[model samples]
Target: MRRDKIAVLVPEMEGKIRILLFWLVVMSAPAFSQQAPKIVSSADTASIRIGEQIRWTVAVEVDSAAQVIFPEGQTFSPLETVEAFMTDTTRKNDRLLLQKTYALTQFDSGGYILPTQRIEIDGKGFFTDSILVMVATVPVDTVNQKMYDIKPMMEVQASRWGWLKWVALGLLAVLLAGGAYYWFFLRKKPLSEEEAEALLPPYERAMKELKRLEQSRYLIQDEFKQYYTELTSIVRGYLEEEVHISALESTTGQLLEKIELLRDAGKLDLEDNTLRQFQNILETADLVKFAKSKPELRKAEEDRNKVEEIVQKTKEAIPEPTEEELLQQEEYRMAVAEQQRKRKIRFALGAAAGLLVVALVSAIGYFGFQTVKDYLIGNPSKNLLEGEWVSSSYGYPPVILETPEVLYRKEIELPPEAMGTIQDLDAFAYDDHRANLSIAAVSTVFTKTDEAPDYEGAVDQILAGFERNGARNIITKQEEFTTVSGIPGTKVFGRGNFKIPDSDEFLKGKYAILLFGGNGFMQQVVISWEEDDLYAEEIVDRILNTIEVKTVI
Candidate 1:
């Protein structure tokens, strides 16, 4: 009996031991969780259309002192990584929670597995849970919506304004240049010393001349004939201007007789002694000039002094002029000043004209006439080609391109029946009708998943859109094209006739279109310009070369 009881108790005791072990493990669970880091993975959405974005995030909680590492580079397989956002951190109770996010996308339509992401904390690797994502195709309704292939570029005639603009610009430039020249070079200048001296009254000018003669070396060099000639002319000029007599042309006897007449008539009130001195000096000058007689230097000096004395006495004896005479003199001086001012104005205008002509000729010689004309008048195509270019990405899948200017967002209105077919669409454009160049970029996202996009049909609709905007007689040439990033698409180029607004006439123009479609997403670029525009042609080619479409397969 005792042996059987002990056996029963032994089995029961084993059961009790198992129960104790279970309790111990339950109590230690919190301690284990606290010792190890916690990692979690999540996504903003489980299903996204192709070319749409998926915000994938991985979060880890570890000790504050621990170092954490996240996956880098193109580590996410089956999906293209658009961007990697910076890690976010949060602190709680001596622990740090780090969260890192990535922008992921796929170009092809299918289901994908977001594999477990590896994370590291304090030199140990950890992993987050795997995730499942669905990439759906954007659909198109070919049966209801009309579609067309790409159209060729058109030929556009040059506008009269093209040349007219250049003419206006040239005139403006000439005017500006002429004004600048006049301000800097042709404006009135201060009077020079000789000019100022000539404007002085006769008595002051004569005295200045005498002082200047005294400073000369003519007497020292023994140039007596030249000296006597200049000496007599100075006094004669003084007498002619101050006394109103013709002293310069008269001989010594004629001059003396005139002075006597004046003195007798009371026109000049001169003393007899002063008259004698003046007569003597005039005779001496005639002898030196006509007979080649050389007088002693001392005699010449005395004669100069005596002449000066005679001039002073004559001036003192002369009566003051009447008010009428003074008024007449003042009017004469004003008239002379007005004539000089007019003369300066004429000279400035002539010089300005000459400068303009020279500048125009030089510009024409250096650059071709057409090129210069276009620059001045402003060629829209040329300016667009040479101006600063911008490289940017647009649309869902992102069409990367370069353009002369930033494109503005264009609002697209869809018909009521088509609204159900298209989920979203974005457009950007730059249109210059005067320059005959129009460019646009468009991207579409479809709603239905039953059918793939009809690329050719869409191209047809785009060509028709051109007609609605004034295109006519389109001739298109379609071919396959590939972007820099190896994204293949359709290219159409041809010429067409475009109607001029408010006129019956149509202009020859050129156009090019590139169409790229996959699954439910479609992107397009259209360019049109006047034919024979080399600058526009170059712009189109460069823009085409820089195109790139981001895709994931």
Candidate 2:
């Protein structure tokens, strides 16, 4: 009886507890909904032409204080992410709306499902719905389109710098030849026998010359005057060297007077007999030569022997040099040797400098100053112009052209309004910031529009784009341009000052834009570079000449 009573009571208590829990969940539903995040995913289009961009966006609304994390990395497979934009945030009372956009594209025609993306809000994971996208190939009506013959190749003239190498080679050859000639032929040589004898001491030299004179036939042939003249010259040269007097320039009387003065001053320790004999010999030579007085051959020989004796006696009379005087003489000799060494070094340096200058001048004369400067310093523009190039076609209404390097495909980002009208946007570009050069090719297909792209409006938009990217002081000129294949287009070109990013410095630049519109598609080719780059200018011209668009018949 007691167990039955307890069971009945327990059933009544369980029923009451279930009702209470149900009411509690009902009351808390609104609060839980308010705290939960709201997530949404969308794309600019569900379909696109091959090589076109699709703008993918994801939005999540959460409490301002809650942390939200979006899917990262290459989460969207089968489709490539070309560019990821910054998240846009907006405040709605106590909640925040975060929007993240990405530019995606596919190179092949296919159908793909954009998988559901996970959004984390306050440590809880929520998901968005999957989306379907279709990519279609660009249609080409080959059956009705007319075919043209391939154009013949035109000859390209050789560069003007071809002869510069030869000129440089010639200059180098001249320098080498000149240096060899100087080293081998014009430099100092060893002394001969006569030169070596001339370097002997005054007394020895004088004695040697007297013996040589005796060996001569002048005395044997009775050439008395000549013999006396030769004999007196050797004596005078000896006196000048040994005594430091101007014996050769002085008269015989003046020469003897100088010697007497020296002896009186105690500078000369010569004996009276030696001086008297030298005086007699000098006076006799003067009379024989100037007065036409021919002395006997025997007398000439005696005079020569006396000259030898006088030189020997003079050398014996001379005082030995003091230590200080010897030191002074040694210093003077060393100083002279140093000066000669320095002179030789200077000469060598000057020769090398001159050779370099000559070579530079010769190169400049043949190749022009700018060419030489560019070659020596290295110009990127020149290298691009001369390097191998790539020829390729880009976009829907294909633009066929050549470039120094292949243009990289880039995703085009457009606003919602622009995406509504433009079905496909393909952009390919190359930029060399260091060279301040840019090249771009763009193509756009309108979504079944009745109107064509306005050429003038497009030109205005391009110019406006330049301004937005730091271009100022724009000057423009427009003209009609026709391709080699007879497709007509508008060309807009001008100069502008482009401000460098994060700096006040501005570089003057030139730009050219070619616009072609047909049916519902448009093609554009833009080229810009620093105004002073001649090589870039040439490259631009070459690219322009090769630009062609496929026309729909």
The best candidate by TM-score is 1
lDDT: worst 10-residue window of model 1: 141-150
Compared with the true structure, the alpha-carbon lDDT of candidate 1 equals 0.80
lDDT of 2 by residue, 1-553 (tens): 9999999999999999999999999999978867667788899999986546789999998889989888787788787665679989999999999999988776557898878878888888888888888988654222224535434444556565647776986898788868756874477778999999987988888888889889999977777788888888998898898888999999989999999998898778898888888888988887878898888767777888888888887887777878998999899989998997777777777777797799899999999999999887878898788766778878776788889888999987898978888899889999987777899999888886444665655677888889998898776655667787677777878788997767889999999999886667778999999999899899999999999886541
TM-score of 1: 0.53
lDDT at residue 41 of model 2 (Cα atoms): 88
Global lDDT of model 2: 0.82
Taking all chains together, each candidate's TM-score versus the true structure is 0.53, 0.50
RMSD of each predicted structure: 20.3, 20.6
